[model samples]
Structure formats: structure tokens, C-alpha cells
Target: MSTDSMERTLERTRRRFIRRQRTQRWLRWRAILAVAVALLLVAGAVWTVFFSSLLAVQAVDVEGTSLLSPAQVRSAAAITPGDPLARVDLARIEGRLMALAPVKDVEVTREWPDRILIVVSERVAVAAVPVGSGFKGIDADGVLFRDFAAQPKNLPLIVLPDDIGQDAMKEGADVIAALPTELQARIDHVEVESVDGISLVLDDEKVVVWGSAERSADKARVLDALLNAAPRASTYDVSAPGQPTTSD
Candidate 1:
């Protein structure tokens, strides 16, 4: 081969190698630039969420509140305004709200941007018990929650001895809960002397002897049948549900 031909071929190979190196360098820098941009974007987002005022708490919204007012719930939550919403401890807020007497359960959540939401489940009153001149509400779990200046007309009165234990109150609550709705409406008060001694007093002053919480459904059924068969009877005994009796 001629020397000029060989030189031209070598020059073409060297130029090709230089072009390849340039392309590879450009690609490496492009990837680094992309990674740097992504990191900056992530850092900016973190700053906005954790330090900037744009995502700070400005309001606290309370929902699912009936027994407690919104202000009451917010007070219990104790979330400070202007704090970063992303930094709010939802579990701690929930624990604080659960300390309230009427609050059965609560959920705390971030509503994004500027608000915190607190959803509460309040205890429902199943009965009332005398306390001083007022009455205290009792839930189905026999937990005393709220107080009323006077006895609530809709809830049955639970008459328990001053020294009665929680078990007696629970038994009385169970007996009331087991009664059919029709019979429940007729109830005026529940007399609980002990866990095993529970009775229902109807509006007409008639007594339904319900011995204990055991077999409460059976007792309720038997009492319903007895009332239908002899509506005018004064005393209905269904403690032993299999053998019910009624006396005038």
C-alpha cells in the first residue's frame, strides 16, 4: 500500500476514536446532571414539607363529634398552629383525645397543606344512673361517661346500690341490651342489687325478674311471650327461661 493511503486510513481511525470519546463524555455528564436535578427537586420537596410555612398547620378540623363540641376535641388534640403538618404526631394526638371520658375511639390525620383532621367516636349512652342531684350516662360497656342535669327521658334509669361493683352495673346493662325494643320502650328503670340480682321495672310499676346476664336472650324471649299471653300480670319471672311464670 502507498504511505499516503496508510496515513489517511490512520487519520480516519483517530478521528472516529475522538468522536466516540466526546459522545461518551457528553452522556456521562447528562446522567450526572439528571441525578443532580432529581436530588435538588427531592431536597426542595423535603424543605417544603418539613420547614416551609406553606405546609404548616393553620387549622384543626374535628369530625364525628356528637357528645363533645369541636372546641373540646381540638383542645384535647392540642396541636399548635404554624407547626409543620408533616411533623405532627398523629398517634400522640389520638392518645390525648382518647383520654376524654366520652371518646371511645379517635383517629388523627393530616389533611395536607394546612389542616389536621380529628375524627372521634363518642360513647353512646345506654342508661343513666343517679349521681347527686343529676344523672350520669352509662354506655353499653357500663362505662360512665357524661352527666346530665336531669335524668334523660329516653334512657332507662339504672338503680344500683351505692356499694354495687362494676360487675353489677354491667349485668344490668347487659339485661337491658338483651330486651327487645318493644319491651325496652316499656322499661322505666333497672334495679340491680348484685351481678346475679337484676330486674326490670316497667312504666306501669310491673316488675320483670331477670336474675342474671346469663341466658339473657332466652330470658328476654320468655318474658316477651309471657307479656303477650298475660299482659295484665304484675310480676313476670323469666330467670329460669325454660320455665317462665307470671303472677298478678
Candidate 2:
């Protein structure tokens, strides 16, 4: 090719390359600017969340405190006004409140915007038992709830040994269910020696002994015969099923 023609072609190619580079630079700048703006917006959103007035607890709604006072529960929850409701650790709050003697269960939940709610079910005693200090009416789970000198509620008394555990409570319920209607009504208190051995102290001060958790239905039926035998007895042994023996 001629020298003049080759030089002209080289200059035109150089101009086109420079223009393309500028265009590429402008596009790159636009992309960088967009990314920076997005990052700024995300940072602002986080800041707003961390410092928003909505996080403060404006009110507290407490429910399920029939036996316990709402004010008392609120105090126990430690969720007062001006606290950070959004940052409230529910697990911690529930744990703290559950330590109360009267509380069986406790729950805490957020009420959105600026509120906190707490719900609690106080323990109800089904029977009284002797603990360290004195006799206390305990719940079905064998948890000590209320003190009882003679009788707290109209519920039947449960006489358990000092070594009795939660299993004894379950054994008591089972024995109560197996007893006859008439005999069950007359039963004022149930004394369990162990899961393997149980006794019923009737209102008439008679002791009905149950041998074990096995053959419960047969043992309960024979108890009626032993009670009606017209012979004053010290212990009615229902452990032997049909052949119940009494010891005076």
C-alpha cells in the first residue's frame, strides 16, 4: 500500500480507540456511583432501625393473673415504660418471671411498634404435703405452691413420704381414678409410700393399703369388701388382689 494511505488509516484507528475508551470510562463511573448510592441507602436504613423511637416500650399488657396481681407480675417482668421493647429478650424475661413461687408457666411477646405483653398462669395446689418448713399444698406436678395447716382447698389430701418424687403424684392420680365412686368420695387423703406401694387414708381415719401399680383395678374392687367387713382394722391390704387381708 502507499505510505500516505497507510498513515491515514492509522490516525483514524487511533481516534476511534480514544472515543471508545472515554465511553467506557463514563459507564464505569455511572456503575460506581449507583453502587455507592445503594450502600448509603442501606446504611441509612440500619441507622434508622437502631435509633427509632418505635423501639421504646410505651405500655405493658399483662393477662392470666387471676390468682396473682397484674401489677405484681409486671414488676416481676421488669418491663416498664421507656425500655427498649424491640430489644427485649423474651427468654430472659420468661426465665426471671418463672422463678416466682406462684407461677407455673410464663410467656412474653412483643406487641409491635411500642408495646410489650406478658402472660402467666399461676400454680394451683391440688393437695397439701409436708416440706422442709411445714405442710404446703402442691400442684399435680408435685410443685409446692401453697401452705396448708389443715386444709387449703376442698381437694383431697395427699400423704406422701419425704422421699416421694414426681412419680408419686402420677401414682396418686391413677389410684384416685381406680377407686370406686363411693369409696373415692369418702377418701379424704391418699398416702403413697412408693410407686410400688400406696395407701388411702379415708375420712373415717381408716388406712387402705395398695401393694403396687400392677393389678390396680382388682385391688380397688376388693377394697370395698374390706371396708364393709364390719371389722375394725388397722390396715386393709389390697396387694393380694382377691385374697385381700386385713391386719389389726
Candidate 3:
């Protein structure tokens, strides 16, 4: 080929390569600019949310608790509507609610856009244990809740073991429910010597040696039979099956 023709061909090839590289560079710049714009838009939206309005609790919802008023439960949760959801911690709210004496358990869930829901489980009073001036209401699991305003007339008074404290108060309640209604009525108070044994002091001053928690219902039945066969003020000892002993 001629030198002039060869030089012209090389120049054309170089020009084409430069044009293609420019197009590619332009495409990369455009993509980067578009991503930057999108990120700025997201940042603006987030900033508006955090600063445009006063961050305060706006609304609160409570569930799973009937005994406590919504206001009470919400107060316990220490959360409200209008509060910045970002700073609103569900764990801290749940912890505060659970700290209340009446609340047994609590769960906090965030309903996005502006709402907080607090679900709660209140302690269930299983029975009452006599204390000074009033009776301590024990929950289903034997945890002591609160003292009644006045002595509960219909509620059975349980005598808990000294070590039972507030937690084991429920055990005494379970034993009370295990006893037969007829035998339960003749009793003034039940004595718990360790959750292991339960003794009943009847109106007639007779002692029921109901040793251990085993066969409590059956043992109570035996006491009923003995009472029917005997008179008031009779001591009916039922520590053993088929060996009920009565004393004057």
C-alpha cells in the first residue's frame, strides 16, 4: 500500500476508538449522577420525617389485659403517639410495663408510620393468704400480688409455710382447690408445712393430718365421711388412706 493511504487508514481507526471511549465514559457519568440524585431524595425524606414534626408519642394501643385500663397499661409501657418511632425502643417499653406489679408479661410491637402496640398479661389471682390486717392475693403460679382492701369473705384463707413467701402462695391455693367442697366448708384455715404437706384446722378444733400433697382429693373425701359419721369439734386425722383416725 502507499504510505499516504496507510497513514490515512491509521488516523481513521484512532478517531473511531476515541469516539467509542467518549460514549462509554458519558454513560458511566450519567449513571453515577442518577444514583446520587436518588440517594439525596431518600435522605431528604428521612430528614423531613425526623425534623418536620415534633417527635412525641401520638398513640398507644394495649392488648391481652382486661383488668387494667388502657390508660393504665399505656402508662406502664411509658410510650405514646407522636414520639419519634426511630428513638422509640420496643424493648425498653416492654421492660417498663413488665416492672409494674400487676403485669406478668408484656410485648411491644411497632405498627409502622406512627403507632405503638403493647400487649400485656396481668397476674391472675388464684387464692388469698391471710396476712396482717388484710389477705395477700396470690396469683395462679403462687406469686403474691396485693393485699385486699378488706378480708375477702368468700375467698378461702390459706396458711402458707413461712418460707413459701409470695412466690409459693399459689401452691396453697392449689391444695385448697384439691379439697372437696364439703370438707372445705368445715375448715377454718389450711396450714401448709412446706408444699409437701397440708393440714386443715376444722371449726371443731379437730386437726386434719393431711400429710403431703399426694391423694389430696381422696384424703379430703375420707375426711367428709368421717365428719358425717362423727360430730362437730371432732378431730379427723387423714394422713394415711384407709386409716382415718378421729379424736375428741
Candidate 4:
């Protein structure tokens, strides 16, 4: 081949190589730009959820608050307005509301957009004890939660021994809760010296020897039959329900 022709072919090859290098560099820069753009979009989405006011809380709705007012629950929750809904601490809110004595269970939830909902369950009282000028009500779990100036209806007075331990209190409350409504209404008070020594005093001055919370349903059925058969009995013993007795 002639020297000039060979030089021209070499020159064409050099030009093609330079063009390929430029194309590879352009593709690498384009890929880096795309990754940077994706990272920025993800950061923006996170900021919107955690810090932006678009999803901030504006109202609090409370449900199942028969014993506690809505205002009381909201105050206990201590949720700040204008905070992002995703940033609210639900477990912390539940803990604060459950600290109240009457609250047995609580659920805190985020209602979409601009609201928080709190639902609560309060304990029910089955017995009462005099404290100062008021009566402190105790539930079946022996938790003293309610306070009233006068005796609450349908709740029996607690006459357990002085310094009665928690076991006696729990047993006495359970016994009182197990009585039928008709019999419970006729009872004036309950006395408990020990877990096994639970007794009920009727409004008519009749005495009921209730032994323990065990077999309470059987005892109640036996007592009902005895009271119906001997309505004038002064004392009724149902401790051994299978063999009940009455005394004049």
C-alpha cells in the first residue's frame, strides 16, 4: 500500500476511538445524575411524613369514655397540635391514659389526615368502703377507683376485717359480684374475715353464711330455693350448698 493511504486509514481509526471514549464518559455521568435525583426524591418524601404540616394533627376524638370525660382523656394524652401524624407517639399516649385509676384498657390511633382517636375502657365497681366523707368503690379486681359522696346503688358495703389483705378483698368482691340481682338488692353489706369466711347480711336482718367464691353459682341456686321455701327464716346457711340448712 502507498504511505499516504496508510496514514489516512490510521487517522480514521484514531477519530473513531476518541468518539467511543466521549460516549462512555457521557453515559457514566448520566447514570450518576439519575441516582442523585432518586435520592433527593426519597429524602423529600420522608421529610413530608415526619416534619411537614400537611399531615399534622388538628383534632382529637375520644370514644368509650362513660366514666371519664373527653376533656380528661385529651388532657392525659398530652398530644401536641400541629405535629405530624406519623411523628405522634401512640404508645406514650396510651401509657399516660392508663395511669388513671379507672381506666382498664386504652387504644390510641391516628385517624388519617388531621385527627387522633383514643378509645378507653373503665373498670366497673362492685363494692364500696368509707373513706373520709365519701365512699371509695372497688371493682371485682379489688382496685379502688370510684369515689362518691353517698353510697352507690347496687354496690354492697365492704365490712372485711380491719387490715384485710388483698386476697380477702379480691375474694369478697368476687363473691358479691356473683350474686343474682334480686338477692344482691336485698343484701345490706358483705363481711369477710378470710377468703373462706365471706358472709352477706340481708336488709331484713337475715344472715347468709357464704363460705367462699368457689361454687358460688351452686350456692346461689340453693339459697334461692331455701329463701323461697322458708321465707321467714332468720338464718340461712348455704356454705355446703348440697346440704343447706335454716335456723329460726
Cα distance off (Å), candidate 2, residue 23: 4.8
lDDT of 1 by residue, 113-226 (tens): 799988899999889999889999998777889999999988889998889898888888888777778888999999999988999999999998899999998888888889
Question: Is 2 or 4 the stronger prediction by TM-score?
Answer: 4
lDDT of 1: 0.91
- lDDT of each residue in 1-248, candidate 4, tens digit only: 99999999999999999999999999999999999999999999889888999899999999998888999999999999999999999999999998999998999999998899998999999889777788988889877788889988767897866688888889888998898999888999988889899888999989999988889999999999999999999999999999999999
**lDDT value for model 3:** 0.74
Which has the better lDDT: candidate 1, or candidate 3? Answer: 1
Give the better candidate number (2 or 4) by lDDT.
4
What local distance difference test score does each model get? 0.91, 0.77, 0.74, 0.91
Give the Cα error of residue 159 in candidate 4, in Å. 2.9
Name the regions of candidate 3 deviating beyond 4 angstroms: 1-8, 34-56, 160-164, 177-187, 202-206, 211-248
Candidate 2 accuracy as lDDT: 0.77
Worst 10 residues of 2 by lDDT: 45-54
TM per model?
0.87, 0.70, 0.72, 0.83
Q: Pick the winner on lDDT between candidates 1 and 2.
A: 1
- Tens digits of per-residue lDDT for model 2 on 1-248? 99999999999999999999999999999999999999999987665555556577898889888767888888888875776666778898898899888899988999877888888888876556656656776675657766656665456667787677778766775666566677767887887887767788877787877866567788877877777784598788887887788888
lDDT of 3 at 113: 62
